[model samples]
Target: MLRGFTPPYTPDGRSSLVPAPPWHYAGTVLSMACPTEPAAAARFLPQGFGRATGRIIAHVCEWQATTDGWELLDPVNAQYREFILLVEAERDGAAVNFCPMIWVDQDISLIRGWLQGWPKKLGQVWMTRSYGLDHPAAAPLRAGTRMGASLAVKDRRLAEAAVTLDGGEGQSLGFLAGPTYGLVGAPSIIGEPTAGALRLVLPGITGRVAGPMASGTAELRFFDAPRDELAALRPTGPAVAAIGNVAITVTGATDMGVVAG
Candidate 1:
């Protein structure tokens, strides 16, 4: 006998809420390329993907982003750094970047990145800004600029990189522009740890190469890393490097597939 009681529901009883606006980020990206063994690189890849060659793309970047949806309001949340170890691989007959390790300086970024299938973890990352000075000798003492980033966990330095930005190079960005995929571990129905592949999709991304190409060296200390997964990137030599600025919208993400336990 229900009388004079109305449920708080619409005619269709469907929720009508709009998704949050995309975040905007502006920053500098310093990149380097290294060669690694095919077998060694394969370990970091998932099913349906194959190593393109033996080249690994490593980069360190510093970014300033808007705090639209971040949980923390601290200044650290507005700015952060990232160190990525990427391997070139083929997926569905096309080349793509397979990210194995990604380190960030903030917890909110780490959590959001993990949900997108990025192998993100908390680490101390730093890089130098562009600077130059005139010298009495040494070719006008014009050192393009020196920048470096290191990943440390609990006072242990896992990786380090040093790069010098000298001048520009006539290289195409299309070759480097592609989709990225990562393996994300999650709890299964039985409460056992399971892993899956997540494909990150960025839409309306627009930007250009802002600075001249760069040359750098990278060193990885597997013994120091927490999981030592980055050891597979045995960087034998340098490939190509560049500096650029970008503005893009993080549309969303999709679960590509599940990894076998």
Candidate 2:
């Protein structure tokens, strides 16, 4: 019998790419909310889901995660960055945010996200870090402080953003605080007539605002990459941005229902 939870399972379950969760994470996020062409955004959602609102979100964050232990001694394996693009969607009149694309820097994080239906891929994600200091380099929680982040994959840049903090917290970006759904399953590989799929809602998401949270003016851009479809969801109007620190945890997925195979 396989001893590990995932592939490359070792007898001791020590070689699995990702460990079992109830994962915990502390992170700083740069979130951008902008209007997108509803029709274009609708194309990314799975069958039975529809565009509920006109806003889309692009978020970049740097995370330190722990599963079984603090992992502070193994910092390299515990830290990673992520970039996500999500659109507002609905099914059976219940609103949910659906992620169309997401990128992560670590293989472990990537695999972990896929297990929760994030459609995460390997990419280079970078962001500005803040510190509680008066140095010119330290971006403190003050009006006019600028921060930036970018995402790239296969050597091609997909999205970039910069924000200048103004003021405010909590309700600065309320739209970002919503339930998210993902379609998880495999397609028929051997030409079978039908396969199975599930509409999974990421579960056990309990977290709170951690540090400085501020509203900001933002500039976001999307580039046309040969493979990345980010250009399709580019913002069509002014964007609202914010910077926040949050500590979050996820247990896995709860069965929302089944969708077309």
Top candidate by TM-score: 2
**What lDDT does the true structure give each of the candidates?**
0.59, 0.80
TM-score of each predicted structure versus truth: 0.72, 0.91
- Per-model tally of clashing residue pairs: 0, 0
Q: Write the per-residue lDDT of candidate 1 for residues 1-261, one digit (tens) a residue.
A: 322112333554322121223545667676677677878887677655665667777667787665364523555656788877777887678777877778888665666566556678788877655533354332211235455556776687777766555554523222246777666575466565554334443222333335443433334333335555676576776545565554455544656656542
Regions more than 4 Å wrong, model 2: 90-95, 170-176, 187-198, 207-209
Candidate 2 vs. true structure, TM-score: 0.91
State the lDDT at 19 in candidate 1.
21
The global Cα lDDT (0 to 1) of model 2 is 0.80
Lowest lDDT sum, 10 consecutive residues, model 1, at: 12-21
